[model samples]
Target chain A: MTVTSPEKAKIELRDVRKSFGAVNIIHGLDLSIEGGEFVVFVGPSGCGKSTLLRMIAGLEDVTSGDIFIAGRDVTELDPAKRGIAMVFQSYALYPHMSVRENLAFGLEMAKTPAEEIERQVQGAAQILKIGPLLERRPGQLSGGQRQRVAIGRAIVRKPLAFLFDEPLSNLDAELRVSMRIEIARLHRELGNTMIYVTHDQTEAMTLADRIVVLRDGRIEQVGTPREVYEDPSNLFVAGFIGSPRMNIVDAIYAGDGRIKIADTVMALGQNFAGVAAGDGIKLGIRPEHLNVAQSSSTALRAKVDFAEYLGSTRYLYCYLPSGETITVEQRDGRDLSSGEEIFLRCDPERLRLFSTGGDRLRSANTAGMPTA
Target chain B: MARTRNSSARRLFANIRYHGFGIVVGLLFLAPLVWSVLVSFKPSVEARQPPLPPWPVDGFSVQSYDNLAQYGSGIWTYTGNSLMVSAATVVASVIVSLFAGYGFSRFRFPFKNALFVLIISTVMIPFQSILTPLFLILTKLGLQNTLTGIVLVYVTLQLPFSIFMMRNAFDAVPKEIEDAARVDGASVLRVLYRIMLPLVLPGVVTVAIFAFLASWNEFLAALILLTDQNKYTLPVLMAAVRSGQFGTIDWGAVQSGVTLMMAPCLALFLLLQRYYIRGLTAGAVK
Candidate 1:
C-alpha cells in the first residue's frame, strides 16, 4: 500500500464542459471525489461517462473549464505529466510486448532505474497473480489474463488516481464477476482514488463507495449505493439502478390521502402535502416490494402472464385490469400459473411517487429524512 | 458408424477439390519462373527456340549467365544499380508512409479526408503517363542520369498506395492502445515508434516489398531518365540486350538476366510471404 504513499488523492472537476464541433457532449458539471474514494460513473451508453473520464485523464481535451488532480490544475497538461493511469475496455496491452515488457514500459519511459523497474514490475505481476504468464505475449493470454496485465501495467505507474473505462466489458460473465472482485480488492489494498466507468449498475453498486448517475451528459444523482437505490432523486435513477428495472405506472391522486388505480383505492398513510386531489401521478415500485396477496380488498387485481424461475426466487409477470404490466418477485413458491387471476399488495412506505415530469415527490414525513 | 464414415468420406472429397484447384492455379503461376530457370541453363541456340521446353534438350550449361557477365558493363553493374534504387526507395517510402499514414489515421486537421483522397488519387495516374514530366523534372533538378533521380521517382510512385495501406494498418490498432500509451508516459513520437509502428510492422514489410519490387523491376522511368547504359537498372539493361541493334539477340544472356531479376523477388516473397498475406488481411476485420 506504500507504493507512493498511503495518502489518498482527490480529483475535482470545476464546471467542466466538453464539446465536439457544434455538438455538446458533457454539459457544465461540477464534482469533487474525496481521497481514496471509489467513485463510479454509471450511465447508459452515449451519456459521456467515458468522455468525462478521458478528460480527467488528460487523454481528451476539455472544451472548457478546469480539472484538478491532487489539488494541482492539470487541464492544460499532457496525459503523461498528469500522473494518472488508465485501464481501457479493450485491455490495450501492446500486442507486440510480452507481459513483463508491458508492465515495465511506462517505468522505462520515465527513466526509472533498471533494478527499481524490475522490482515494481515483479511486484505488480505477483499482486495480479500473473507471475507465471510474465514471458508470454498478450496474444498468448486469455481475455482475463490480458486484463490482469493491463491492471498490472497501471499499478506499476503508482499514479495518484486510476481511471477504468469499462474495464470488464469485454470479459465473459463469469470472468467479469471475478475481475470485478479483483478490481475491488485492488482498490482496497492500494487505497488509491479510483474512478470507474461502467454501464452495468451491478458493478457500480458493488464497487463504488459513491455512485454518480448520469443521463444525457448531465449528473442525475450522486450518492452512496443505498442512497441512490432506496432514495432515488428522479425517475431515471430509480429505473436505471436496479436489475429488471422498477415498474412505473400511472395513478390518480384521490382526496383524503388516497391514490386510485383502476377502481382500487390505496392510502398514502404519510401526508404528501403538495399533491392536489385528482392530479395525475406516476407510481414506482421495486418488484421485491410488491407482495402476492390471496384475497385482499385493497390489492390491485392482475392476471398472471408469465413467470421466470431462478431456483430460489421467481419473477411473476402480470397485467393489471387497467392494462398495465407489473412484475413481482416471489420466493415462497406461490403456484401462480399463466392466465390465472391474482392480487398484489405493496407496503405504503415502499411506494414512490413522482410528478408527471419524473421528479421524486417526497411525503411530508420523509421530507427531512435525507436527500440524495 | 456408417454415418460417421460417410461424413469423413465427404470431407475428404471436399478437401481434394479445394486443394486440387489451388495446386493447379499455383502451378500455372509458377510455370513461367520454372521455365525461366530451365532456359537459363540451356545453351544459347536451344534457349532461342520458339517454345522453350521445361528441360533443356541440348543439355544444361551456365553459358547464358556467363554471356550476361561478359556483355556491355555486365549484369553485376545493373544488379548493383537496381539494388541501390530499390533499397533507397523502400527505406524512403516506408519511412514517409508510416508517419503520413499514422497522421492520416489518428489526427484530424482541416480537409483531412480531402487530403487523403487527394493522395490516394495519385495511384490512379499511371506511371507510364507521367514519364515525360518526370523526365523533365529530373533534368531540371540536374538529376537526369543519376541513381538518386531514379530513387526519388520510385519513392514518389510507391508512396500513394503505401500510405493508404499503412493508414489502414494504423487504423486497425484500437485508439485505446494509443490513449493507454499516452497515459503511460509515452510521448506521441514514442507511441508511434515504440508501440504503434511495431504492431503495424506487417504492413511496413508489405510496403517495403511493394516498393522494392516497383523500383527493382521498373523499366520505363529508368529507360527515359537514364540515357547512360552504365546507369540502367536490370530491367532496362535487359531490355537493351533483348533488342539487339545490329546483331541477333543473345538469347542466353537475356534469359540469364531475367533469371537474375527473378531471384531477388522470389527470395523476398519466400521470406516475407506470411507477412504479406497478414498485412493485407489485418485491417479487413476488427
Candidate 2:
C-alpha cells in the first residue's frame, strides 16, 4: 500500500496574508518550500507560527495570495483535498477509539478498503514502534506513547506532507528531546515534505532542514538551522537560537571592520559593507564562542555575576563595564565565583554584528559564515 | 494534660457536628423516595393510615401491581408516550445543540457575541411566559396533540440549556484537536464528528439526561398540550390519577403506577452515572 510519491511539489506561497477582522496576522509572508525538505516555523508565543501552519494545511483561509501544493492551487481548497496530515500539541487522539482505530481513522474517512487500511495502520504502528500499544486508548498510555500513536495516525494517511503544531509540547522535557530525534528520524525515513510549528528553539534547531523564524505574525528569517544560527539574517534570530542564548551587547563601529565595546576595541579582520564610523551597532556572540581569555588577548573585562555549571561546561554570566551582560561558555569546567573578575574574548571572526535597527550587517568575510 | 483534653474535645465535637449534619441532610432528601417505594407495596388502607405505612413493609403484595395493570386506563400507554417523547428529545436536542454549540464555541460571525447572549437569555426567560404563544403556533401547524409536537416543544425548550452545557463542553475540549483534525483531512463536520464529539460526550450525555428527565417528568406542558388520554404522558396521567376521580383514592393502583413511572429514570441514571458524574470532573485535568 505504498503511495507512489505523487510527484510532490515545491509548495510556494506568494504574498500570503491573514487577518481576523481589523487585526491582521501573518502580514504578507512570502515563502517557497522545496519538496522532501523538512521546514519548521519557530517563534515566541503569539508569533502566529501555528497560524501559518494552519494556513498551509488549509485549516485557515488565506486572506491574500495563492498557495500551491504539488502544483495544485489549493488556497481555497478543503483540507481533505489539500493532501496534508497534522499532528497536534494535544495529539487529538479519538479517546473512545483504540490506537489501531485512531491510526485507521483517516483511511476510514477516505473509504479505503478494510484490508488496505489495516495494512497501513500496521505499517504506521511498526514505523512509530507503538505496535504493542495499538489496542490501547490514548488515556491508557503515557504521554510519549500517546504521541507515538498520534504520529502513527498521521503516517497511515500517507499524505503529500505532514504538518505538526508543537506535537511534543505536551510531554515532559526529557520526552520532548527524545521525541524530537524520533520525528527527525521519521522525516528521514518518510522522505516526504514536513512542516512543523513550535516555539521551542531546540525543536526548531535540531529538527528543521530549514527553519522559519517568525515574530509578531511576520517571518523574520528563513534558512537552514546552520544558516539561521551561524549566519542569522536579523538580531532576533541571533538572540532566539542557541541554548545559553547569543549575547547582545551595545557596541560602536570603531574605524575599520572593528567595533568598540566597553573600552575594548575588538579587531574584526573583515570589512563590513554599509557600516559607518559612528554607527550604533550590537555585537552578537554565541556563548560557546566567548571564553576565559588568557595571556593578554584583546578582551572585554567583566565581573562574573553568577555561573550555572553543567557537568561538561559552566556558563559564566559576566557583565561589561557599561553593565551589559554576556554569557561565556567555559567548556573546561572552571569553577568561577560570583563577582570574580574575568576577561572574555570572542575570536572576532565569529562575532555577529547587527545594526541598531536589528538587521544583520553583511561583512566582507566573516570566517564561519557566508556573507549575504 | 490541657493539650490532650482540648484535642479530645475537638475530635468529639467535630465528629458529632459534621457527621451528624451530613447524615441528617442525606436522610431528609432520601426519605421520600424510600417512602414512595415502601408505600407502593402497602395495601390501600395501610398506605395513608394515620401512622403511615410501616417501614420495610409489614407485608408486601402484588395486589397493587395487579390492580395498577387492570384498573389504570392509558397508564402504560402514557408511560410509553413519555418514553418515546423523551428519547426523541434526547436525540434531537443533542444533535441540534451540538451543532449550535460548536458554532457558538468555535466560529466568529458578525454579531457573534450578541447572538450568544440572545441564546443565553432564552434560558433566563420563564417557560410559562412563552407557553401560550408556543402552543398556539403548534396548534396552527396541525402538530397539537401529536408526539412530534411534544418532541418539538421539548427540544426547543431544552435547547437553550443544552447549548450552554455543550458550548462549555466544546470550550473545555482543546481547539487544537479540531485544528489537527482539519489538518488530517477532516472537514469541519468531520472534525466535530471525529475529534470534538467524543471528547465532549460526557457533557453531551449530561445534557441528554437532563433533556430526557425534563421531558419525561414534565407535567404542566403535557397537561396543556394534550387532551387524548392515550397521548397523555406519565406526569400528566400521574397528576390526573392523583385527583382520585373515583370516590376514594385507589392507593394500591396509584402507588404501583407511580412506582412504575419512577423505574425508567432510575434505571437510566444508574446506567449513565459514569458520564453523569464525569461532567463535574471534565476540565479538572490540564
Candidate 3:
C-alpha cells in the first residue's frame, strides 16, 4: 500500500480545443504544468475553466489536440485510466454506499486485494478524520462530512493528481475558509499536482501556487499570487485579482514625460514602448495606493459618495471630475462626509497603464517602486 | 377575538367539505368490490335477483366459492396461468424498461429523442386498431395458444409507460453521480445495475406493479392469443364463465371470479402504495 510519488508526473496540453457543433468553447491552448505544482484556474462564469479542467480529466472530449499526463499521451484514455481523481462541487458520493464502501469502491473495481483495500480505506478515513463516519451513508452525513468522504474516496486511489471543480463553493463562508486551509494542507502533505477551478479570487489568491486567469475561453495571465496582484498582464487581471477592484480611468498621453487625466497632468519617469502624445490609454491604481492629498494642480479632485468601514480599513467611494468612479482605501479612521470634495494622489510608479486593447504596458523603471 | 373566531369557523367548514368529498370519492371506487364480495357470499338464485345492493338478502355462504371449480379446468389452473403470465410480464417488462429507461435518460444517440417518441407514442394507439394485425403476426410466429404470446403482448403494451416511469426515476439522479461511478472504473452496465438501479428502486417497483396489474386484468389479448382452454388467464376464464351458454348467467361464479382477480391487485397495491406514490413524483420536481 505504498503511495506513489507524484513529483515525476507533469501534465501538458498542446493546442487543445473544444467546440459544440459550430460554437467554440475552448480555443486552441498550450500549457505545461510542472510536477507537484498547485495550479488554480480562476475566471468568470462561461470562461471555460471548468470545461478545460474536464478535458484534462478526460470527462470531456478535447475536440482537437493532444494531452499528456506523466509523459503519457492520454487524449484517448478513459477517465479511470488517466491516473487522476476528481472531487466535484456536488460531492457526488454514492448515496446508497457507506463511506467505507465509497472509499473502497475504486480499489475494488481495480481488483485490489481485500486487505489492501481495507488498509487504504482506513488510511484515507483517518487522514480525513472521517473514521467515525465511515459506516454511515452519504445522506446521513453533514455537507462538510460528505465532502470529506468525497476527498477520502479520491485519495484512496492515490492518483497521480487531484482535480477539484469548485469543491468549496457549496459550503458556508466559515466552512469554506476552513476547508480552503484544509485543502492547502492536504496539498502540502500529498505533494501531488492539483488543478483546482474556482471563480472566487480569494481562493485563487490564497491557495494557488500559480493562478491561471482565464477570460472568454482563453488564458489572460499565468503568474504567482504576488505577481498577478502587483504586476498583472492585462487590465482584466488587474481588475479581477483584487477586492475593491483596481480603479481604472481614461487618460491621454500629454507629452514625452507626462499624462493628462481630466485636465490634471502627472509626470511619468518611465518610457512606454508604443505610446505617443495625444493617444488615449487607461490608468489603473489599486485602492490602497491612492491617498488624499492637499488641494494642488497635480492631484485629481474627487467628491466622496459613500464609505464602507471594515474594522481596520475604510473604502471611500468617490467620483472624479470626469464623473468616473474611484475607490480609495483609508486606514487613518478619518470621518469623511459624503459629497465632501477631496484631492487624491498616488506615486507615479504605482500606476498600471493599459493600451486601448486592455493589455498591460509595463513601466521600464518598475525597479524603483517599493514592494508590498 | 371576532376576527379569530371568523377564521376558525371558516377553517372548520373547509375541513368538513374536504372530508365529505373524500368519503364520497373513496366509497365510489370501493362500491364495485363491495358488490362483488356480497354477491360471492349470496346463493346463486338470490345473487341473480340483485338490484346491486350493498348487502346480500340471503344469509352468506361459501357455495359460490365452492362452485368456482366446475368452470374451465378449475379455478386453480386459471389462477396459476394468470400468475405465470403476470409474473413473466412483470419480470420482462421491468428488465427491458429499466435498461431502456436508463439508456433513454442518460445516453445520446442518433435519433434518440425520435426513437423515444416513437416508443411512447405506442401508448396512444388503441389496442383494437392493432388487434387484427397483432393476431395475424402471432399466428404467423406460431406463438398462438401459448402463455409466451400473451406475456409478450402484455409486456409490449406495458412498456411505453414503464419506460417513461423508469426514465423519470433515472433522471432524478444527478449526472455527476454517474460520472463519478464511471471515473471509479465502473463499466456502463455496472453503473446501471450497481449505482443507478438501486437509486431508482421505487420506479422499478412501480413498473412491476403496473405490469402485474395490466397482465392480470387483460382480457381481449389473452382471449385471442391464448386459444387453449388451459392457458386462459383469470380474466379470460372469468369472461367465459360469465358468458354462460345460451341465456343463463351464474352470478355467483361470475362474482367469485371477479373477487379472485381483485385479491392479488389489492394485496399488491396495499403493500406497495408508498413506492407507487413516490415513483410518480420522483422526477417531477428534481
Candidate 4:
C-alpha cells in the first residue's frame, strides 16, 4: 500500500481553484501527478473531475493557484502550448472531415508540413488500428470506430501528456472492455503521462497506475488501485473503489478489546488496549472476505434475500436478523438460494474498524497485518 | 393473399388521391405564372383572350417581345439593378448576421439579451412605420435612387431575422465542437469561420436565399427609394407596369415584365430548395 515510484514531480497543482463568476467549482486542489504515469481522477457525475482535467489542460483558467507542467509554470498557457492533447467523450471529431483529416487537424493548425502531417496521421491511424477507416467521415463510422479516430487525433499530436474525459462511456460494454485494455496497452507502449477522468471505477482501476478519488470537488484519496481497494484510507475510498461495495456495519466497542455487532461479539486482536468500552464504531468487510468457517469466534444468523448465479460464482444478498443487508461472494458450488438460513463468519484480522464518522480506525493487529 | 391485394390497392388509391389534391393546389397557385408565359408569346391583341383552346398557338408571335424591347423594355436595366442590390444584400447580411449570431449564441457579454430582444422585436414592427424615417436618413446620406443605398435598406431590413436565424443555427452547433477547435489551437474567429461555419452551411444558405428573395422582390421601399428609371429595380419597374406609361395599358410589356421579375426569385428558390427546408428544420433537432 505504501509503494511509490519516481517521476513524481511532473505535474504540480498548487492550490488550484476554478470559479464561474461567484460560484466555485474546484476548491483548492493540490495533487502532483507523476511523469509517464497513467493517473485517473474518478468520482460521481458533477463532482468536477472533468472540470479539473480541463483546468489542468489550460482550457479552463485556474482561478487561484499555479499549474506546472514538467516543472514549468503553465497556468496561463494555451492548451496546445502546454503540450497536452485531449480526447473528448463525444469524440468531437470534425463531422464533415474524413478520419485522416480529423487526425491531422491539430498538426495542420500548427502548420506542421503537409508531408509530416500525413506521416503522423498515418502512424497514429496505424497505432489505433483505424487505418482503413481513414477515408470515412465520422457520420459513416460506428461509434467505436469514431472513438478510435478521436484517440488517434490525440495521439497524432504526440504531446507530453494526454487527457481523456470518459472516452469509453458512449461505447457498448464489449467495446468498453476492449478499449480499456487498449488504453492500458497504449500506456505501456507510449509511456507518456496520461490523466483520465471517469465516473466508472472499473475503468479507473484498470487504467490508472494511481487513482485520485474525488468527491464534490475535493479529493478524498490518492493511491494505486490495490491501495485504494484493499487499504482504503477512509470510508469514501473503500466504498467507492470496489464492486459490491465494502459492507459497513454498525458496532459498539465491548469491554476487553472486543466489539459487539447486533448479536455477535468479535475480538479486536488486543490492538485497542488503550481504548475505553462502549465506543460507537463501524466494521468494514469486503464481501469475498466473509466466509463460512467453523473455527471463527463470531457468527451472524442471516437469511438469504436473493442469490445471483454467474456460472462459476454466486452472490448471496443476505439479511441479518437486525435487518442489515450484506452480500457474500461464494466461488465454490453451493446450493445457496433465497430465504435460506446460514451463519456468516469473518476472521478477526479481516475486519476493518472505523469511527462512526466514516474514518477508518486503525489498530495494530496482534495476529499480523490484514494481508489483502 | 386477397386481403393483401386489397390493402395494397387501398394504399395505391390513397396515394393517388393525395397527389391529385396536391396537384390541384399547385396548378391553382401556378395559374398566373403559366398564363404570363403564354401571354409573353401571344400578339398584343391575342394576349387578352382567355387561356383556352391552347391560346391559338398558330397565331403566336414574338412581336410583343420585340415591341417591348423597342419601347425600352428596360427589363434588362431593372434586372441588373435587382441582381446588384440582392447580391450585395445577401453577402452583407449573411456575413454580418453570422458574427452577430455567433456572439449571441456563444458569448455572455453584457447587454446580450437586451440586444437580441431588440433585434427580434424589430421583426414584429411593420416596415411601413420605419420607411419614412429610414428614407429621411437615406436622403441626408444621399443614398436614395442608388443601388448601394437600396441595398443598405435591404440589409438593414433583413439583418434582424438574419441574426435570429444564424443565432439559432449557431446554437444548434455543439459548443463542444468549437471548444474542441479552441483546444486544437484555433482562435475564436478561426473556430467560427472554419469549423462552426461549415457545419451550419445549410442554415446559412437558407438565410441567404431568404435575403435574396426579400431584396429582389421588395416593392414599397424600392418605389420610395429609387427616383430615376435607370436606378429602377425589377419590383419597382413591375409595379410601373400596373400603370401604363400612356393612358392605355401596355398588356404585352406588363406581362413580360411580371415574368421577368418572377424568374430570379423562383429560380433561386428552386436551386436551394433542399437546403432551405432543411435549414428551417435544423433548429428543432439541435
Candidate maximizing TM-score: 1
Model 4 residue runs over 4 Å out of place are A1-9, A270-276, A292-297, A364-372, B51-58, B67-73
Q: Model 3 compared with the native: what TM-score?
A: 0.93
* DockQ: the better of candidates 1 and 3: 1
Q: Give every prediction's interface RMSD.
A: 0.7, 1.8, 0.6, 1.1
List model 4 lDDT by residue over A222-289, tens digit each.
Answer: 88888888878678877787888898888888967789988888776666533458888877889999
How well is each residue in B1-286 modelled by candidate 3, as lDDT tens digits? 9999999999999999999999999999998899888889888778778455646777887788888877769899999999999999999999999999999998878899999999999989999899888888889999878888888888999999999999999999998899888789988899898899889999999999999999999988887777789888999888888888689988888998888889999999999999888988897785
State each model's CA lDDT, in order: 0.91, 0.84, 0.89, 0.83
Ten-residue stretch with the least lDDT total in model 3 chain B: B49-58
DockQ for each numbered candidate: 0.84, 0.59, 0.76, 0.64
Q: Number of the top candidate by lDDT?
A: 1
Q: Rate residue B188 of model 2 by lDDT.
A: 78
Candidate 4 chain B, which ten residues in sequence have the lowest lDDT sum? Answer: B47-56
| Candidate 4 chain A, run of 10 with poorest lDDT | A1-10
Residue pairs in clash, model 3: none
lDDT of 1 by residue, A1-372 (tens): 123343488888999999999999999999999989999999999999999999999988999999988888889999988888899999999999999999999999999999999999999988999999999999999999999999999999999999999999999999999999999999989999999999998899999999999988899999999999988988999889998789888999886778988778999786675688899988899999989888777998889999999898999999998899999998789788999998889998898988888988888666656685
Q: State in Å the error of residue B187, model 4.
A: 2.1
Ranking according to lDDT, highest score first: 1, 3, 2, 4
- Per-residue lDDT of B17-75 in model 4, one digit per residue for the tens? 99999999999999888888777777877765555643446577776666566444456
